[model samples]
Target: MTQPPAAGPTPPPGAGWSGADEIHDGLPAAPAEPGAGGRGLRRGLLVAGATAGVLVLGGTGYAVATYVSGGGNQPEEVLPADTLAVVKLDLDPAAGQKMAVSSLLDRFPSLTSGEDDDDLRSTLVTPLLADNEWGLTYEQDVEPWLGNRMAVAAVPDPGSEAGVAGVVVLAVTDEAAMTERLEAVPADSFAFAVRDDFVLLGEDQALVDRLAAGGSTLAEDAGYTEDVDALDGDQVAVAWADLAGLQDVVPLAEAGAGLGDQALSGRVVLGVHAEDDALEVTGLTRGTAPTTSTAATEPTGLAADLPADTVAALSVSGLGEALTTSWATLQESGIPPEFEEQIEALGLDLPADLGAVLGTDLAVAVTGDLAAPQFGARVRTDDPQRATEVIDRVAGDAELPVAVSPLDDGYVLASDPALADALAADGGLGDTEAFRAAVADPDDAGAIGFVDLGELIDEVVAQGGDDAAQAQEYAALGALGFSASTTDDGGRFVLRVTTR
Candidate 1:
């Protein structure tokens, strides 16, 4: 963190700050430039605002020590049941969680650059408040009142033009100090009310007052509770959005590139957790569009059958059925007629011919040295000859530099014919220790993705630069694995990075 230049004596509380009126009208406008410290303060606030925006769309940290001893209350317990979206960060986690976080941060030195302390106040908050014109140091102002947990939520606001208002919930250790801190800041956009150990901040007094009243909270909503409960492991941070409610706040059809109504009728929840050796992020959705195909419930085995030397691979089941189902859904949703004409112009049927080419199981793999890599696509087709004929027709006079050949049960398209022959001869990717350690429940997954990092790490080390040292940190990193499967209601996915 770059230190800002020294400034004159600190201004009196709420002294030189401007833009208080903007809080009532809309978002707080940038305060009038005061000195170097003031400029730093402005930059910090902007960055914080941008992070909040991302949380509202996608969905960190702490005042640590206070909550670790006696875990803080969950933010959802206090938020309104009608809240559209929420992002919460837990600073004080369990002992194992602390280690996982530290180990993960060690992998990337830049994030911890110029920092000597691990305490959140020292390493994070202090830097943001270091040279503010208000002369407010985290130690003197924030640390005294800040607690361990914080969250931001989007709630319905009939009075707002956007039809939604933002709410911030911060855990407080000292209500009096928290009150003084708020008064010291000239901004009035944040009308606040204290309830128990937490303070609710909103655009207006009515909103915070409503939260304080707290009749039916989000914790009582069955759908929200189910999604959060589905997440495995103890979470360090969590984000959730009600897709149906979000559509009203954000234009889902345009934003999601023509998503159907069914797609926007679900709830999405994302959780971050620290494992013994790896940090994991899990996502789950419920009550979304339904697919009748059961092929995704069974493993394809195409990936495991790839050559043992494969460095990266992706395998997906039920592509054919999924394609047909999606096309039918799109038609029902009223796709532009021109889109269908474009497909016809390409000399292909809507889904029949495409489905045949993709087959039920599809896997793509990369092998050999990085300088001379080989790529192969394997498709499990009932009629290999017909699939080959379609490939030839698609290639037509283009004279593509690839070969199509038959496997025991399917067809393989390879940039190198020898690679295809190798696949037919032998495959042991499933037997590799790295693969076994990385992938989980491969036999039941709908989709699987994997990458062996050993060779890639070596290649980076050979280059021998500043990055070489950083790459070395990943030496213990064996591979990365991803798996997705359909659930009774919707779908679930997990991503894991394993270390030897």
Candidate 2:
């Protein structure tokens, strides 16, 4: 198992954690009006007036609480830390989602070493939980307990701003009436929910990619349609909404740092709306927690200075053209709308020629040459319809003939084979000093990227081989474009070569 990186190089206490869960203030909105019942409306009016008075006259009104939950329970397919390695996501949610599934599908085991209880809570968890509008903010941090099964539920305050990890939400319209809603949930049902997922960026990039494509799937989606008993090693956790509800959080037996060590604390905001559904949940922060286990002091080579710009840069950073060429591989998969949004949200830049290839919703813009790959996905949608529209727009207007087709649950539209053949037949890869020179210049530093020799070798091997290993290798290639072909027995391999 790979060991955690040294603490000496860790990001400053506030580095990656600062914006982990940031909910921008001032989204557009207007004051809610009273409800339908004359008596009830009068009561709500009085409360709103009173709350407003406390704010204007008293000048010490507490913040309104806010929380968000995924509409109902969304099914989850996961590989917790126990079964495999933890996967750190790009601060971008969609990108993180793709990275999660990709890491699992690729087969990288969630190694024992990952963001440990303390590190996760402080760096990755605290900000997410505190930033939410739940009105209860704690600095305690929380992380996924590698070996256990867990679930998470969050009850948000009706009128506050906050951030969250992975949650769906609805607006609440009633404030005072919420007492009934809170009372209805079984006291036991509000125990605790574990938010568990894995990080696949392993010490070895190849190992990480292999796992993303074919890792062991530990937790299957529970469907959440009916009450299901907890699986072995599973824990039932409760979610919290307003300050009144959260007040009891610490009092719960299973509350501190958490049983599995995946807990972090942050601030929560609240809102008291006239209607029960008008309340909005804004952020989620993990709890800052202490642990008993002695952390592994061994260090990995990964740098700890993950600034937003740097992190965003790493989102595109790689060793060679594989990233630049990722369009081909991405083309091979279905366009998951949510994944696309991640790319756009990362705010990566796009090259005109390549941008034309990926469409707008999601495009892997390659920056380095054949060696060092510095690439980023231009993610743009959570709606598949939007993703398809983007594909249509880009492929439809391409200067070259674009062929659109589905593969492995996703879709890819690429330059016509005939056009590619025309280029190949004309010797695009041979005697083309300009292309080779440009591809070899990633190390110029003065240029867009500095290439790495290792990536070049990987690309060559992938271009010649068609085995599972080669397919896996192609994923790590800086260029994210290509098709991995394997023999029936999965022995023979041929990676149809292409570039973004």
lDDT of 2: 0.26
Candidate 1 has a TM-score of 0.75
Q: How many residue pairs clash in each candidate?
A: 0, 166
Worst 10 residues of 2 by lDDT: 59-68
Candidate with maximal lDDT? 1
Off by over 4 Å in 2: 1-118, 121-124, 132-138, 141-422, 426-500
lDDT of 1 by residue, 338-373 (tens): 977756665776577777788889989988765567
lDDT of prediction 1 = 0.68
Total backbone collisions, model 2: 166
- Number of the top-ranking candidate, with TM-score as the measure: 1
TM-score of each: 0.75, 0.19
Cα lDDT of model 2 by residue, 433-492, tens digit: 222222222222111211222244344455453322423322322211111111121111
